[model samples]
Target: MRERRTIIDAGWILLLLIWSVTILFPLIWVFYESLRTNQEFFQDVWKLPSELKWSNYRKAWEAYGIGRAMLNTVYYVGASLAIGTFLTAINAYVLTRLEFRGRKLVWGLIMLSLFLPGINALVPQYILMRDLHLTNSLTGLVILDSLSESAFYLMMLAGFIQSLPKELEESASIDGASIFQTFFRIIMPLSTAGIVTVAIFKFLGLYNSFLGPFIYLSDPKKYTIGVAMYQANMIMQYKTDWVTLFAGLVITMVPLVLMYIFLQRSIMEGATMGAVKG
Candidate 1:
């Protein structure tokens, strides 16, 4: 029996190792290659660099004009996460806690939208942006991403809010607090887990967003990391300076990787708890 248990543990460990390698090997390879010069790439792509090219990062940063791109990305990500999370929380609060007419139909409509392909709306969205002269603007991008995310987050947060014990709200309300005060000061604080989960999701999407910026922002100066990376690859006519490209790629992914690593536990617990409606 002990032998069998040991064997089972070994099997699980081996499977986990394989999964880790599958996820991490690409990132490791990128790091290795990013330190190599263009000459080294042709000589032996697999070989280690004679000396690490730390300056590859600086060159990539300047060449891609990633300073401006990063700023734009931060604005887009920060605004979308802030606005989207707020709207989703309020939407979920109303749907789960408050009495309202046509609520079921409203929820049904939102669920139906989840099945619709986002691509189907792109052409129409572009046309609307053109008509409104919102293309090439930061505010337009933030609004678009915020509205784009409403349905999914609303459903996720609604499930979490519905699972909370009603007694808590009742007890708070009995203390002479208005409904707004109860929600803002009491319920919203308890719902932080769900909010953080949705915020992380929005941050990932908005930070790495490609399609929206690619279509909307024609101005090179306003490009995000996604667009800037694409241009870096394209400028060399598809044979991009591999070292610089890889360095830029690493820089682009590092912040998000660190963010997830730091917040991963909260993200997982919140997401799971949010979905587990009683």
Candidate 2:
């Protein structure tokens, strides 16, 4: 039994090491490639550059208009995060804490929607956006992203909320707190872990979103990072400047990587806390 356990542990460790290498190698290669000139990269794809062409980054930034796109992305992400987080929190709180007619049916419909592919609604959504004249602007994107419901985040928050002690809510009520007061002042504070987790997920989704922005936005000035990256890739066909494209890709990853690094612990905690109830 002891020998078998040791063998299993060794197998798991080896598998993890392989997994780590597979994930890290591409990132390492991309960064290294980003330092080389297009000529150098095409000549020797596997070899390191003799000298780093740091100007590739500057060229990419200027050529692709990534700065403007990043600013637009920040607006979309910020607005979506604020509006979506608040609405999701309220939706979770209502579903988990309140008693009302058709509540289960509403939740069932939400859950059912989760299994449906979003692509199925693309035409309808696009038509709606076009009709509202929101197809080309960040405000329109934010409204579309925020107003839609996320059943997964809702369920996670609902589960976490359900796990909280009932006495706290009762005590708040006994102390003359209204439902709104109890939610904002007491429940919201205590649910920080879950909220942060959902916010991070939402931010990542919004930031890396390509499909929505690609379809809705036509102007280069209003493009997000995802669309900007696509534009960079397209430029490669004409310019053949792979290094600049790589540099843009690297820049695009920095914000998301930093965010995950900072919030990993909270994300894990929220996942665990939510699982405790359901």
Best by TM-score: 2
**lDDT (Cα atoms) of all candidates against the true structure:** 0.87, 0.91
lDDT of 1 at 164: 84
lDDT of 1 by residue, 201-221 (tens): 878877878999999999998
Superposed by TM-score, candidate 2 places the C-alpha of residue 277 at a distance from the truth, in angstroms, of 3.7
Model 2: per-residue Cα lDDT over 89-119, one tens digit each: 9999999999999999999999899999989
The clash tally of candidate 1 reads: 0
- Choose the strongest candidate by lDDT: 2
**lDDT score for candidate 2 against the true structure:** 0.91
